[model samples]
Target: MRSIQALPEFHVFFNDHVVNNFNTLFISMPSSKEYYATGVSGSVHNRLFPKASFDFIHTSYSLQWLSKLLKELVDKQSLAWNKGKVSYPNSAKEVVEAYKMHFGKDIEWFFNARALEIVSLEILWFFLIPSVADSHCKCVIIAVFDLLGSALMELAVQGLVDEDKVDNCNLSIPDEIASLIESNNGDFI
Candidate 1:
């Protein structure tokens, strides 16, 4: 809503469970680009939180923007060939490859960092873009929307495209969280 500088230091912080008496700090940024500029730093995390640290990490629509995983894939595919056009099957393969080569690491690292913050018995719920719940139901409302979005962009441009699809694939982050908690059994809260 407002710039991180304009808000009180703690306004952006939230702790679902209050432990000890440490306060939740909020570091709100005005725009997504700036929000990311502020959010993505190991140094910024340390500085703004100079004497404080987190016990849990939570996020909503923000992670998608930060990674720009899908958008990057689309851009790469669109530029892969001469005449500014890519073949249908090639486009699909390029997209998949981009995801595998690029976004895969970013997603893995992001969650790994988050997993370290959660303690035993803590739950992290994510409302993701391609949400797990609707992943398989092709006829679901959002599935259609995803199809349309793909169609409007690469699918239509590439032609001979039978179905434009966005797989609502969901990942099991709880296991990662549990592993982190178990690994640090006696080290933290």
Candidate 2:
């Protein structure tokens, strides 16, 4: 927080796909702050800034939502199609692989896009609820999603929820930080 206050001048850009809520965001910005705030409404899968324009970038709990679900999961003819579950569990190997593949592509796209926008050695802080198993693990987010999927499955069994709708939904958890490092050639830390 001190580093933020110490900066000479800075501009904070809030980017999202939704434009209607931006007016509320702009109004909430402090008028007395030393920095400026701007909103850019778009998908992060594409470039959002000019080359070497940002010194720092931060993303929190957003990258898990892929731009689209995995192709095989949506294709009716594919054997790897996710027919019943809204999200992947360890039990479903093919579904898990599909989610992982999609996540890898999404993360690669994110890093490549940011690499163009961020200056050399600049910082990129990604805050996510890691899907790691530990003694002290409290993965509430994952648990909530799992519960939701379970609920949807139950509703589908009761003929209340559409099976296709549940089958098409997925939330990816990119837990392989080392893989991301390796894929990006160690350019980002």
Winner by TM-score? 2
After superposition, which runs of candidate 1 have C-alpha atoms over 4 Å from their true positions?
1-52, 66-91, 115-121, 131-189
lDDT (CA) per prediction: 0.37, 0.74
How many collisions between residues are there in candidate 2? 0
Q: RMSD of model 2, in Å?
A: 4.6
- Provide the lowest-lDDT 10-residue window in model 2: 129-138
lDDT for residue 153 in candidate 2, whole number 0-100: 86
Across 57-131, the per-residue lDDT of candidate 1 in tens digits comes to 556644333243245433424532211222112233444344444433455555555555555326556544443
TM-score for each candidate, following the candidate numbering: 0.37, 0.78
Best by lDDT: 2
Give the CA lDDT, 0 to 100, for residue 55 in model 1: 47
Which sections of candidate 2 miss by over 4 Å?
1-7, 18-20, 27-35, 132-138, 157-160
Clashes of 1: 6
Candidate 2 lDDT, 1-189, residue by residue in tens: 355555477778888886559988878878886777888987786689999998888888778778776788888788668666555553256766776777777777788888898887558887765764332344776667778888998998999988888888776766665677786787642
